[model samples]
Target: MQRAWVIQFAGLAAILLLLAFALPRYAQMVPEKIADHVQHHLHEKGMTWAGVRPAPGHSRSVLLNGSAPDAEAQQAAVNDLRSLWYIQQVQDTTTPKIIEPYTLHIQWDGDKLALDGYVSSAEDKAEIAEQIRSEFGNNADLEKLQAGLGAPEYWETLIHTVLLKEIKPLPSASVRMVGHTINFAGKVATTQKAEALSKALRPIEEKDYHLAVNIIPLDIIEPYTLHIQWDGDKLALDGYVSNADTKAKLVEQIKSAFGDNAHLEKLQTGSGTPKHWETLISTVLLEAIKPLQSASVRMVDQTLSFAGKTDTTRQAKALEKALQPFAAKGYATSVNVIALDNAAVVCQREFNRLLTQETIVFSTGGAGIHQESNALLQELADAAIFCAGTTILISGHTDDVGNEEDNFKLSEQRAKAVKGWLFRQGGVPLERMKTSGKGASEPLADNDTEAGRAKNRRIEFVVEGI
Candidate 1:
């Protein structure tokens, strides 16, 4: 028995050496060998072979050959090819996959499926993820997810063809969330984009878009920097389109001046608004005369100072009148809109207009005069500037935009709100002024669009006998 076993081992060793040599020589022949082998077998029953391509991440590729005239022949060829040891896998395939544009490349790391591809934005990412789920139904393994479709190369091409969509990315708009607030800090070409961003983010209940819209007194016409940030319940903002405090004051003051019953305070802090900030300060040149156009805003020791080339006396007086309501509303006020003289400059522009004309003003729905208004008023007072003690008329007017009565009421409320802020709050004597509402009866322009309507819905100075 021992001798027979030894002879059998020697025979096996010789056979193994011969087979190893034959396999090395045959490795090169597998492609054509396999293709020919497949075709010949299929031919015995009448058939042909079609296509082959590289399998991702491997030197060996898959070749799908043999076109069968009948379903049975097709299935049989596929089964025969798949049964071969040299063939990793096999399936029927069609042609013309050459014309696709987008390509998906994926890496299969054992732990997590690393899905990496160029996606334009939030929407694009969501869409592709959804499409993948729809096609493969969420899966944890490569076999179930991408590989389930076919060879890796085939799957990559298919996804690129069907999944990707070409879209010009919306320029990056910087936003930061501080606490419960969102603040914007960048420049977008259009105002609609800024507004849309704010509106769209309404889904998060504990947050709001607070903008620090920068505007120069005359250098530019449009807002320079539009900053946005998000917080737990609000928005924090910081940017540099220039005129930082000016933008903050303008938004808050305008909202307060117009009287937004729906007052909300959500803005907080950021940076990177530089270009827009400088552009904002330039806008000051757009509306006012040459002298006032150069006016600048500065913050020192928590106070805002206005510096410009306007008249020392007139601008100061205007500032006093403008800030009166905010002071009355119990805000710590200050201002200085004077010519480049030794004295501080504080120009009272809007409030005085309201007092004299009794025009109604409408707010943009979130905030009112805020602290800056009061500080502005205090500045005027400290500058010893005061408007004539005329029985100033505070009138609120709306354009022919919405309900006339509502506009009328809004106008009245706005005027009265200022009066309360000025006299009852800022300490202006009640007897010095009164409020009224004129609903869209006056038009400075055609009330067909926003600019026209805005002109029409102004709070102006209509002199009542002092």
Candidate 2:
């Protein structure tokens, strides 16, 4: 009986020892099994990019790693592992998939609606395409939609509520979404429609997303007319432009040229403006009117007429020739720039007649003028004032009464005396008058007789810059 008892004790002790040895191995295997099961679960759920492993030093916990397509997928994986009987805890260490510069572009051009760029998922792509097809008819082109990650929150809401809603009433439009930014451009039939669309887009703008809206109105007016007149002191602008943007650009150009003296009179905006109309108006204002003293440019329909006054025939002819190219390209140009030389010629004749009536008497053999000639000098100045901007030459002549050198000196001094008087009393600029001394070089009758010498010793005035 004692031998049997010893054998039973030894067997029991050996069994206990065997259990102690195998239990540690089984415990280790349990973690491995849990890891395998977790990984299989992830695979069944289509989380191919994810992996799971038993937590170090912890038997019932797992660490999930790798990239998830979105936050929802990562959370779902964690929840799924936690629901398992063997998993006490789940440590999710997964990152969201990255897509840089996530973008979506939509365009509707009267006949066709085209959709392109990235969407968050295949479901999102299908839904967006369906929405576009329903709203814009079957003309939607959705072949370019590609599934990607990194879309902003409520991205589809922006497209459906803001972009599509605002652009639906337009004739032609395009909307682009890149990251948190949205840009919309379109053309509407009236100003009221454009304003309403702009107002509708305000909600998106207020949400701190970068938003840009460009809505153009297509109101048309018949027989577009623009008249610009510069009457020496003030410039008047009366016109009809294609749109507000065109009107702004035109006004800016006018302000740049005419400064604050420009008066805008009933300048309105509408469609039906000729092609390149702004370009033609700018050319006339900037280039053609530069040399004109008083200018008028008129545009009615396709015809552009320019009438101005310049100082010379050369300027008139040059301006007319420059504007001729517009005529060759379907634009009718009527350029009538009158030269002021005819008025200058009439002034010259009047001055010459005044000088012939009574010569300007100076101190004998000196440069000083006599007080008796003041009335005639005043008359000459009044005549010169009428032909403003004309260049006048004040020439001094002397007879053979003195040495040639002395006569030259006297003639120059006399011419200078007359020029100084004109500048001081007549308000004539010194730059406008040129003085010369002919010193008996040019003879009126032959400088031999007393009367001929007196005529030769007189002063002469010539008008130039015609």
Candidate 3:
């Protein structure tokens, strides 16, 4: 029994070893067999036979690697193999591909511009250099090291007429032309300039040739600098300007606006500053805020930075609005607008607190101001004076104890009485004040309770026209 078991085990082991050797041999011979079959057919067709490679782990797929003078001849060889049923798949690996025409490039930096690429002829090169000089001004640094067969007639015309003109305004720009496609990149001084350049190139877009543009605003150092200081007592001005004439005009305007209270130490240097800069500072920035306690204005390059304290929030808002034109034109700006303690905002909060704690009581149903509200009214008046260029809105309300018509009439009368008191006692102008009544239509608390009703029957003040 033991001898018979050993013979069975040996026979099984031999069969396993045979499979390991035979499978790889079969895998190795596949490509050779396919090569033979492919060669036999290729010989009859007068085509040379290149080697064949079987696809890894795939039984029928193979890579028929070969080359031909042209794509048409290569396709013909591939089509011949498709008729045979044995080869399931064939990937034709061929060489000598069709390529597009070469590209040309031009780069501009500061005052210098460099051109490097191929052109069809020496005349085309000279023409391109001349075109650059004309478009970018005579001061532009130009270098051309381009060579090739005479450029295509279309390319030569496009560079001279359209592309050169489009990139002229850019302080720094690069242009690349690939066949019919042209791409542009550069820096402009304003958002409007960038948009204008983009709009101009829209006509150049076509099915055969394409045009692309990218422009970033120049935001380094601005042309001039403005240094303004308000030291809680008086204002001081100093910094760089475009020229002596501009400085004289600006100083005169500042003196006119603030009178002898301001000091000027400004120097004029003809940097790259904008023409409308004086108008921007004296007209927009300074006009927004008056009666400042402390402030400073600094402008560098195309950016404006200001820090200061105003007596009221209204002044701050006006200053922000005044700077809108600069922001819209792509001037980077920042403002630190600090409202003083005596500002209207602080007074407004105090008024709200006083009204919430103690109601402005009137005698019965009459439009008489009560004595208890004397001190608070005086405080509200003091706040109103500081908040210049704003209007005061006084609204009155009453609990729903009577008919709607009677309640509305009483509210209106009470509001008018308060307005008269503010005008007579507080000295606030009538044109800067308006009075209204809601007859308990708008309430701060539930009217079902006595306390809530007391809270609802009150006078409220709102600041408008800020």
Per-model tally of clashing residue pairs = 95, 0, 9
* Number of the predicted model whose lDDT against the real structure is largest: 2
lDDT tens digits by residue: candidate 3, 42-78:
7678766343566565667667775453454466678
Task: Quote the positional error of residue 97 for candidate 2 in Å.
Answer: 6.1
lDDT of 2: 0.82
Error of 3 at 120 (Å): 3.0
Model 1 misplaced stretches (Cα beyond 4 Å): 1-79, 82-99, 105-269, 276-309, 312-418, 424-466
lDDT of each: 0.44, 0.82, 0.71
Compose the digit string of candidate 2's lDDT tens values, residues 1-466: 9999999999999999999999999999998899998899889989888898888888998999988866667777888888889888888888888777888888988778887887787778788877877788887788887777788887877777777766776799988888889889998998778878888888887767888888877776667898877767788878787778877887898787778788886889877778878777777455677557887788898888776777787877888887875786688877656567665776688678889999999998888999999888887876676566789999999999879999988998999999999889877888889999989888787777898898888888888854
Candidate 1 C-alpha lDDT tens digits along 1-466: 9999999999999999999999866765555555566556656654443444433333344556433333444455667767767766564663322212322333322222334322323344455567555544564233322111112232332233421210011232333332333333333345445555445434433223233322111233332233322211222233333334655664564344334432224332222232323323233211222324233344222223343334456764665564344344333334444443323212235345323443233346311444545654443222222333445566777778778778788777766766666664556677766788887887778988888886776554333542
TM-score of each: 0.27, 0.41, 0.34
In candidate 3, the residue pairs with backbone N, CA or C atoms under 3 Å apart (3 or more residues apart, or in different chains) clash, namely: 120-149, 120-150, 120-151, 121-150, 221-301, 222-300, 222-301, 223-272, 223-273
Model 1 scores worst on lDDT over the 10 consecutive residues at 162-171
